[model samples]
Target chain A: MTVKINTAEQAASLIDKYDTFLFDCDGVIWVGNELLPSVKETIELLQSKNKKLIFVSNNSTKSRIEYIEKLLKLNINNIKLEQIINSAYSTAIYINEVLKLNKDKKIWVLGQNGITSELQNFGYETLTLDDIKDKELTMENINNLIDLNVGCVVVGLDFQLTYLKLCITLQYLLNKDIPFIATNIDSTFPFKNTKLPGAGSVVEIASFSSNRKPDAICGKPNPGMMDSILSHHKLNKDKTIMVGDRLNTDMKFGSVNDIDTLLVLTGIELESTVSNGHPDVTYYADKLGDLYALGSK
Target chain B: MTVKINTAEQAASLIDKYDTFLFDCDGVIWVGNELLPSVKETIELLQSKNKKLIFVSNNSTKSRIEYIEKLLKLNINNIKLEQIINSAYSTAIYINEVLKLNKDKKIWVLGQNGITSELQNFGYETLTLDDIKDKELTMENINNLIDLNVGCVVVGLDFQLTYLKLCITLQYLLNKDIPFIATNIDSTFPFKNTKLPGAGSVVEIASFSSNRKPDAICGKPNPGMMDSILSHHKLNKDKTIMVGDRLNTDMKFGSVNDIDTLLVLTGIELESTVSNGHPDVTYYADKLGDLYALGSK
Candidate 1:
């Protein structure tokens, strides 16, 4: 079906007609610790309309608990903990489901405490850099660890990296031919006011060293994450729209899921940049306040 | 020009008449310190015939002094310290003669102690990894250290690899668009009892990371190294033959330098494996003793 809209006013009316609202946190809500001026107002207005709102972010560094605490501190009202979808949480769910289906296997995690803790919580024996710190990092160590015993490798962000860790992980991956699952593909992270290597760097290095690309990426704007978001909200493609600042990740999510994306220029991505990228973004707004103005009419 | 030989005996007779002998150590003399039998006897026989000999290895890890010491310890010949030619020495000479021809620009090395020492001996100011260990390994560090101020990056073997070192070195090389001179492309090194990542691994990673391959390879099979060997020994390609086990590295040396290569099956590469490889071997010998048989005939 065609997107039934004639004006910015019609667009606003159509957005309000949906009971479910999905919002991207980074560009739309705030950039870093600073909150966008109209983000709270937009969320509160959606809540007043009895719309079920979900805050989704591709950033996997922080847990949902951390996000909820930050959101509450920002004075955004009428939001529940369950309404937050994060790459970390989705990654946890994926690991849990895979383990349930497979039944007998250990998972080796190449991430920080959050991923390890989540895997451990799911009753799967999780291995992290800390676990292998005492062991010599070598091909032999990898061969001993990987051979037909371990199930899969889950890659995430590890700030304190070493050649030994990378070498061992790469050798194990290449030798055993194990499947790799990454949390997300954000190449760099905004850390301490500087862009630093993130999980994507590890993924890129591992892929290069092993000569094998990742088997699966569990975060947005991958179809698996979008499917989980849609299924959890009981939303249909025609009834939903993706709203985000970044064109590649957010706009891509909408286009891939067959939902329209409203590109907001106030965040990491600009309208001019997304204009040429696909799937093409449906609309562009200067700010989140402009989106609120649509519903006002 | 046509490698005129009607039989193996004719090939043996031509090898016997050659007065100056050039030998490649890796996949020729020994592979990771397991000596090829008859290598000692062949060298002794060549010495008895008053033939000038040079034991050249593309391995940049050890200096000539170290190679001479190792060869002496292995009981491999009546050879002088100057008879051993290593890639580190060749790299130093290249930096001094080619890269630092202006005699003003300082050369910074991203390699082992041997390379730095060689460069210093050649009257070039060399900065070792120790000089930049404390600096943040970023593109900025590379820019700061290696702008138009630096001449070239001489890549060799470094055991203690850090991301910062790799990042800075790569950034500097890419930023300045400077020529990179690699010692060799051996992917792995046979360590004491296990295999370790070699210079080629670092080169491959840095090349992939920066999206730029090395500008020049100063080591083995390259015409520069082979030419150096030929000039130092005053050898005739028509009469001389390169007897080494590895086809790609050793045999390529002969082809690039217009000499003949006698493939020996006692070391790293097998004849069956390299049948389709470059510089199709002029002769195949199971061991170095087979070459002595040629000389004897």
Candidate 2:
């Protein structure tokens, strides 16, 4: 059964078990732009204990640098570049280190600037949706519109996604030699008061058109994404705990990686959802701010 | 074994076996507005023999009326409205006779005028992509944008497919009570010596975003499409043969429906493709024109 860290003594006692914490940013740290209650004090308490804090997010729309800027803007201080692990940065890392694609070949992107920006920052040239978004697809210009030099196709969330982008992306993906990668396949994302279709919804069009699955879906819930993180960082599995609000992605990420997980109830999950213990989650907390209760005590 | 109707005697002798002929329009009779060699004389020969010639096409873009206009424009004479069996028409028939959707509820279409025209002609109300093509998806207007009167969602080939159409289609499909249908799932269609993404590729976005398979795929090879034709027409299956260029959709349609199949060249397939007899196909011809040889003889 999953333990509930209700009291300040229990929350303080739970902190002693893990030296490093992997935080899922959206729900645990902040909801959209506004910081959640007691997030600052909780983080300060973790830092006072010298616990390592890493923000692991599935935010494919923002690069690590962009994410860091947002974190600092949120007044969450002392965040390092290496402390961020987002699907965009993870996707770039996968393409660079795992695929080891040649530097000469360009990456074709069916996404926004975050993907291209990260890929370019990683020393790889990219051709994004802007290159062909405005062009019309016709028998006359199809051959010219498709870039044969594109070695990899990366699909992420594009606010301005159109049929033209999907058509061009499908043509490239049809070439078996060209690798297709999706940053993440989150079905939907929260916007204001509701949810909208995310990258998973968009990328599946190219996958269906090509009649092929993506070479890599580099995101949470996939053990390979965690493996990529493990290879980059030198951390002991016993000392780390993944902290998040979502059970399927964040908690499952920890369980598959053989790390512990702490689920907070401030985001997508409700109090009633944790009535039964999930195989992935180790403990449930009222909120991330529960750790700050110990500091006040 | 599949017989090759090479000689006039063989072609004439084969015509006596089937009283009804289901013709695939795109490749067998015509190839993109240009009639195939001897299609007129061959069709005329069949008509003179009192053979029923039904134009079965996977054309979801143009309605039956529009298709008839194209046939007349091409000077293909003696065509009857009942003789045309396009996916657009088949889809409407399926929605009307099989699904029995209420006449009051409106159908939301993610396709061209073909789907809407057919549905509207069949005494059903519809709203196409044009209705929401200009509307932007925002948290503020999501409630007002989605029409609750939508009873079914139809997806077909939309040349003007935009992100807005996909986003709206997904919202309706998410409601399980609203039936989801696809006209066909042909991966690619020939366009001026090139094969472009077809309705299958376009409709999959809604299917994936909604995370569910369509309730019905009303097109060739499904057997359900042929069933729709059978339900409407008083033809003997034993006396019917499906003539098409493609083996998968056309021949398979005949096989599953317990009808014989005639393979014709001059479309997508070549001589090498029919070297061995396929279980579904009964005979192979150099072209649909081979049947015209008997007239010349």
Candidate 3:
């Protein structure tokens, strides 16, 4: 049964039970640049109680440091750069740490500067759309002369996606030995009030063409995104709670990893949409501000 | 049983059986621009016997007229524009004759000039990437205000594909009432010794993003591409043969529609590839030129 937070006592009991709080940024804390009302105070209250606050986002467009800068700009204080974990950061971690790829193997990225930069920071050579600018480039030209050095294809939210990039990605992925990795398999990226094609949409082209599935999807709900945080901090799953707005990514992520999930109604999901079939989301609140009841008492 | 035509007597007897020949251009007729040697002589010999010949291609990159021009340039005589039925041509026919879409309802095309031109020829209002060139275009602007007048979204081989085109395609397709159409689902467009991302790749992105499947695929192996030819001609199914190199598209198209199929080794398929599980192909030859044995007798 999902515990509904109706009063200060219930809220306080729930909040006090967890030593660490994992927050999904886009919907729970703020939607777009505007901060959800009282979210600042709610987070600060959790911080005052000495609870560990970590912001986990599937938005691979921005790096973790950039997210920290945005958070500080929004007046969200007491947040460290280490406290944020974006998909881009986790993807690099999954590749370098989990996959244990060799330093010599390069990655062909079909994403923005954020993911590319994160991979580069891990001391791996990366190639982007800029690498294949030859006007005379064709399939035959590259067919005989494939850069076999490229061992992985990393796909993320790319606005500058092109046909040539997809061709190159397919060529690499055709070799089953060379892994195909995606930051997230989100069909659409909801921004403001609308949705655009996300990383999954771009990756689907190569996947459909080559008849291959992504070897690893390093994002929320995958559990690989939580690797860095789990290693750095010691937290019990029983006491830890994940708070987010989206049911698929955030709620599923928490449920899949055995952490208690708190669903908020500030974003992608609605109260009417939740049902008995939903994966275990332990609690539901109107907004993060409702958690402020813990400090009120 | 698929008869292996290794001898001239078997080849001649098989060729004499079909009154109407439907050819898949890529593998059987020619690989790329270069026509397979003896294919020209074989086609001329078929013409001398007064057999009706039709060049059916799923390559929507060129119009029927353009295909005729290419054929004439290669010195293949006696083929007219109407004798060539391309996916683009049939897609237009399917929309006009089958769908019977209202003339006022404009179509949003995510393909090349070939399909757009064909739609325009049918007196339908067509919009393409060139139509949405306003510098201020964004997802937000198209969010609340959608072009609801769009009755269908046609996806095909587009070399100049862009992200905005995909966004618009998804926006229209989300309506559910609006139809999603594809020229072909051929994974890759085989061109000049290389395979490039084809129409299927572009459609996969929109299909994945929208969580929708194509309402109609107007290409070979789908039966819609042969609809126009079937409607116009009164040929017997037993006397009509689909000659092509690939077992999947070409042979399947014939088998699905109850027409005889001939598999050639000049393109995608080899003798080793065919098995009992595949759709029935009536005959197999080394190349299109091998059919010349029929005339030699």
Candidate 4:
């Protein structure tokens, strides 16, 4: 399809027709601590038009409250706590739902503080590798431990990845047919000024060694994350547009769920690099300024 | 398709109709160095019927002379050098043909002594990582070096694999977009009674790092190896039956080239594993002794 007009009237008309406007945090509203020039104006315009606004980010390191605080600091105040969707929040909901079905199950988590705290808050017993330091670890020992108590493996990004951890995880999964769940499947994470292997890389290594794929990924691109957001906010899919720069993650969410996508060429994926053009992208813009132009009309 | 069985009388009747009987060396006669019982008898029997027997192996690690020596030790004597079809020979021929078409070209050979020597014999100048050892090495310098005078990259199992070698090769390939040809795709190699990562593993790493698959894999499971065998020996595909045990490699060879395959259970792949069955295997035998049952008619 043709790239829609960059005028404010056309964008406003599209926005008015759709109930939910999902904005990608990075590249759309802000890039690292700096907000885009028209991000606040565009959000205000959408609010005035009686449209629901939600910021969806695949970055699982931050929580909803963290994102809201960041946004409020950028002068985009009046943002509700429920308006942010992060992979970690989706993962927390997934764990809670799974725990509700199986009331007495223990989960071994491989993530940062936010993930462990969230799982514990859901009344599930959570253990880390550090918690079992005294145990003699082998693939067989790990399998026996998992067979006895561990219900499911909950994996997230961990900066201090070790060979011992990978070995133990792979052995346990391989010996006993254990199902694994990951927060996201992003191969790399943008850390400081360079790229580092993310949580997905750990999942990939374990999956490759054991020949078992993750049971479910509770993150972006998967409908689970989007569905969690929509269900939480009582938002309809018919009136939702997913705005992101990456096609595989952002556009995939829109395409899989039949939501409109607004592809902005301001993030990780460059315009010239996206060869497999998605049919879901209803609008294309160079920056958030073009989006504000649509809001004015 | 129903497996067609030609009785001894039928075989004897049609034995004179065919001139050359091209035999696959691996599973037909032996698994590695161990000879199959009645393999000699079968060859003698075929020769008694005035048929020419030629042995073809996709394993390029050994030269035609080496194969002749191995066959001679197994009591199959006086086999001509021209009867052999191997990737090493084919690689030499490919480099010669390419060089004939384009005279001024340098090739980086990432393989063993066999392939390197063969390519050198074909009048093409071959370079290895050792050739660049004297030069100052850095990622930038190595990348710049790869951009100079590189024509083609030929890959095979290199025992002396290093990170520096891999980085340089990948850099040259990514920068220049040079054509890559792999000698084989066997992921694991049977060595000293243990399986080690073979040529396919290195090829996979290079492919993953550069995001470009080999231009052509000049070995097993590809039509190139089979076609070279058929064309060089002047054998028709209809009469040629590839006898091998492995389903993925040997059976895949017959499947792609429309040749019949005889699955012998004495090798790497077992008979029970062939239950799901490939369309390529026209016949199955527990061992060479079972073939004598057809001869008894």
Winning candidate number (lDDT): 2
lDDT of 3 by residue, A1-297 (tens): 776677888888887899999999888888878999788888888888999998988889977888888888999987887788788877888888878889899998989899988899899999876875554565456574357799888988888776767777777887889988888888897655667888789878878888888887878887777664565465677878999998888999899888899999898787866644355678888888888844465
A best-first ranking of the candidates according to their DockQ comes to 3, 2, 1, 4
**For candidate 1, lDDT tens digit of each residue in B1-297?**
223243557645755777666677766787667777667777777788777777778778777887877788888756786677788877766655555544466665767887888778877776655775555655444444434566667776676655556655654565545667776666665643444556666666555545566766667777656655555556677777777777778777877777777777777765556555544576666676655645555
Sort by TM-score, top down from the best: 3, 2, 1, 4
Interface RMSD of each: 4.4, 2.1, 1.8, 7.6
Give Cα distance to truth, residue B129, candidate 3, Å. 2.2
Worst 10 residues of 3 chain B by lDDT: B132-141
Quote the positional error of residue B124 for candidate 4 in Å.
Answer: 4.7
Q: On residues A41-72, what C-alpha lDDT tens digit does candidate 2 reach at each position?
A: 89988998999998987878866887789888
- Rate residue B151 of model 3 by lDDT: 92
The prediction achieving the highest TM-score against the true structure is: 3
* lDDT by residue (tens digit), candidate 3, B1-297: 777777777877876788999998877777768888788999988898899999998888877888888888788988987788888888888888878889999999999889998899999999876875544566567564356678988998787776777777888887889988889888887555656788888878889999998987888888777665676465578889999887778888999889988888888776777644355688887788888854465
TM-score of each: 0.75, 0.84, 0.86, 0.61
- Over the stretch B190-215, how does candidate 2's per-residue lDDT look in tens digits? 65455567898877777777888888
For candidate 2, please provide the TM-score of chain A on its own: 0.88
Provide the lowest-lDDT 10-residue window in model 4 chain B.
B94-103
lDDT for A165 in candidate 2 is 72
Total clashes in model 1, counting residue pairs 3 or more apart in sequence or in different chains: 0
